[model samples]
Target chain A: MTGIVVLAVAVMAALGFGLYRRTRDGRFAADAAAGDGPTTPTTPTTPAWTAILAAHPDGELGERATLVQFSSAFCAPCRATRVVLGGIAEREAGVVHLEVDAEKHLALVRALDVRRTPTTLILDAAGRELGRAAGAPRRDQVLAALPA
Target chain B: MTGIDPRGPRFTAAVTALIVAAALVIPSANLSALLMFIQGAFFAVGAYAGVQYTPTAVLFRRVIRPRLSPPTELEDPRPPQFAQGIGLVFAVVSVTGYAIGPVLLGQVAAGLAFAAALLNAVFGFCLGCELYLRGLRLKERLA
Candidate 1:
C-alpha cells in the first residue's frame, strides 16, 4: 500500500514538473541577477566583446545584436539551439550568432552565472546582455524576445 | 564529437522508469531488490563504458531505430552518460536499502530515480544532465 502511494506520488510529481518545464523551456527571460529590469550595466571585470571575438577569432559580433550561445559537448538541446540561432542570424541583417564552448570558457561561464548549456545570451551592439534563455529556445520565442 | 540518436536515452529512460516503478510497487521485497539490481547493472555499464554500450541503446539501434524514421538530429553522448552515473548512485542506494533492514530507505532512493527517469522518458528532460552542469557551476563558485 505504501509502495503504491509512493509510486503514484512520484508519477504525479514528475508529470507536474515536466509540464512546468515545458512551458518555461526556451522562453527567454531577463536575467534574475539583473534584478528590477534589463538596464543593469555589465560588471566591471566583465570581458569586453572584443575579448570574446579575440578568443574565437572566427566569430564576429553583429552590428545591431549578437546572439552568444554557451554550449557544451554533453548537451543534446545545444544542437537544436545552434540551428535555431544560426537560422535567425542568417535571416536577420545586422545580427550574428556566436557559439562558445562552455567547457572551454570556464571563467566566462562562472562570471555570467551560466547555470546550464544551450544558454543563449542576447547582447546589444554595446555588448550589454539584453536577455538570456537557459534551454533550447524556439524560433518564435527567440523572435519575440529580440529587442525591437 | 560522436553523435547518437537522441531517442536512445529516452528509450533507456522509459525502460528504466518502468523497471524502477515495478521495483518500488511490487509486494515482494526480494523481487524489488532483484529488479533494482538489474537496473543498476544497466546503469553501471552506461556510466562507465558509455551510453551507447548500454543494452537499451543496443536494443534501440537494432530493434527500434529500424522501425522509426531517422532522427532529425543526433546529440552528444556525454550528458546521458553522466545521467547514467547519477542513476547508478541511486540504484546502489536503493539496492542497499532493500538488502538492509530499513526498506524505507530503498523506497525513497528508488522513488527519486523513478521520478527522474519518468521526467526524461515523458518530457525529454534530463535531470542528471542538468545536475551535471549545475555541479560545474557550483564548483566554479566555490573555487
Candidate 2:
C-alpha cells in the first residue's frame, strides 16, 4: 500500500539522520579531545566559513565583522535567525549580514557541511575564522565575537 | 447512525484517492512520474482553495443550505490567512523544484510533498504545521 511505502521511507530517513548525527557528534568530540580547552579551532579543512565568506560579494569579513547565515525560505529557524541577526546587524554598522538560500545552493551546502537551516558563520573584520553556531546565537555570544 | 463531519471526510477521501493513484501507478507507468511532479502543485493550491471555502460552506450548509451543524468540533479550524500562507510556500517550493531540477528528481520531491499533504488531509496530521507554530513561539520567546 502507498501508506506502507511512505512509512518505510520515513523510517529510513529517521535512521539516516540518526546515523549522521552520531557520526558528526563523534567527529566533534574527537576534534575537541585533541584541542586545548577554550581555544577556537581554526583550520583550512574547516572551509565552511570560507565558502560562507565567498557567498557575499563584499567577502566574509568586512570592516566591522560579518555574520553569514545559510537559510531557506521554508525553514522556520531561518525566519528566527533573520529576526535575531537583523537586530545584531542593525546595532553593528560594520557587520556585513548575508543569507543564502540552501535549497538553491545545494553544492555550496554540501561543501560547507551545512545540514541545517539558520547555520551562522562568524568572521573577524579581516575574514579570519572566529566561530560558528548552528542555531540562534545568544546576544552575549554575538557581542563577545565582535571586534573592538 | 453515528455522524461524521463533512470537511474532514472530504479531505480524507481526496488524500486516499491520491495515495491509491500513486501506489497503483508508480513503477507501472511513466505518466505516474507526472503525478509526483504535480502532486505538490495541485495539493498546495487545492488545500488553499479547500480551506478558503470552508467557512463560507459552513455558513451556507448550516443556514441556507439546510445541513444542521453537527455536535463534533471538526469544522474549519484554520484561519484563512494562515492556511493561505502555508499553501503559498508549499506551492512556491513545488513549482521551483519542478522548474530547476531534473524532471525525475523534482517529481520525487513533489511526490514526497504530496504524500505529506495526503497525511494531513486524511488524518489532520500536518507535517509542517507545528514548525510554523514553533517559529511563532520562538518569536514570542525572543520578544
Candidate 3:
C-alpha cells in the first residue's frame, strides 16, 4: 500500500515538473541589473566580448544582433530552433543566425556556461552579450530577447 | 536524428508507465523481473538499433499508426531513445535491487522510472532525456 502511494506521489510530482517545463517559453528577460529573472548571470565572468567572438566558429558578429545557437548533433529541438531562428533571421535584415555544434565546440560551450542543447546567446553588433535562452523559443520570444 | 513519427515513443512510454505502475501496486517478485525484462528490451532496442525495432514501436507502427491520423511533424528519435537508455539504467538498478536484498529498493527504482515514463507519456517532455543532455554537456565540460 505504501509503495503504491509513494509511486503515485512520484508520478504526480514528475507530471508537475513536466507541465511547468512545457509551458515555459525560453524567454530570459534582458535585464541583468534588476537581478531576478531567468537571465544567465548578470555579467560575464570570462574574457572580453571580442575574445568570445574569436572562440566561436562564426568569428564575425551580426550587423545588428547575432543569434548564436548551440546544438548537439542528435538534438531534436535543435532542428526546430534552427527553423525558428533561421526564419527570424530571414525576415529581419540586420539579424544573422549562427549555429555551433555543441559537441564539436565543447570548450566554447563550457566557456559560455551552456547547460543544454538549443541554448541561444544573443549578441550585439560589437559582440556584447544581450541575453541568452536555453531550449527552443517561439519566433516572437526570440525577437523579444534580441537587443533593440 | 531519426526522422520518425513522434507519437511512437509516447505510446511506448505510456505502456511502460502502466506496466511499471501496476508492478508498484502489486509488488510481486516475478512482476519485478518481468518489468525489468520487458522495459530493458524496449530501451536496449531503442538505444542500440533504433526506435523502429523497439517492441512498442513495432506495435505503434502496426496497430496505432494505421488507426490514427498521420503525424503533422516528424521529430528526431535520438532524444527519446536516449531517454530509453536512461530508462534502461533505472530498470537495471531496480532489477538488481529486487534480486539481491531489499525488494523495496527495486520498487523505488521502478517508481522513479515510472515517474519519468509517465512524464514523457503525459507531458510530452522527457526529463530523462533532459538529464542525459545535461550529462553530455557536463561530460564535455569536465573533460
| DockQ-better candidate, 1 vs 3 | 1
Poorest 10 consecutive residues of model 2 chain A by lDDT?
A25-34
List the lowest-lDDT window of 10 residues for candidate 3 chain B: B125-134
- Which residue pairs show backbone clashes in model 3? none
Q: Write the per-residue lDDT of candidate 1 for residues A1-148, one digit (tens) a residue.
A: 6777878899999999999988878877776544334445445334346556655778776887889998886687888999999999999988889999877877777768788888898876766677788889999988877766
- Model 2 chain B: lowest-lDDT 10 consecutive positions: B72-81
Native-referenced DockQ of model 3: 0.61
- Give per-residue CA lDDT, model 2, range A53-79, as digits (tens): 455445545577677777754343355
Better of 1 and 3 by lDDT: 1
| Chain A TM-score, structure 2 | 0.61
What lDDT tens digits, residue by residue, belong to model 3 across residues B1-143?
A: 34888898889889989878876776576776677767777778888887778888999999989999989889888788778888888888877876774777888888898888888888777676566556777776587
Better of 2 and 3 by TM-score: 3
In model 3, the runs with Cα more than 4 Å from the true position are: A31-52, B140-143
| Per-candidate TM-score against the hidden true structure | 0.89, 0.41, 0.88
lDDT of 2 by residue, B1-143 (tens): 22234354335325433643463335533344444334434445435655434433445445543554553433333322244345445444534544554434434444454544454444433345434434543554477
Error of 3 at B50 (Å): 1.2
lDDT of 3 by residue, A37-73 (tens): 4334355434225545666645566798888888875
Q: Which scores higher on lDDT, 2 or 3? A: 3
- What pairs collide in candidate 2? none
True contacts kept of 1: 0.69
- Candidates' lDDT values, in order? 0.85, 0.49, 0.76
Cα shift from native, residue A14, model 3 (Å): 0.8
Candidate 1 lDDT at A76 equals 74
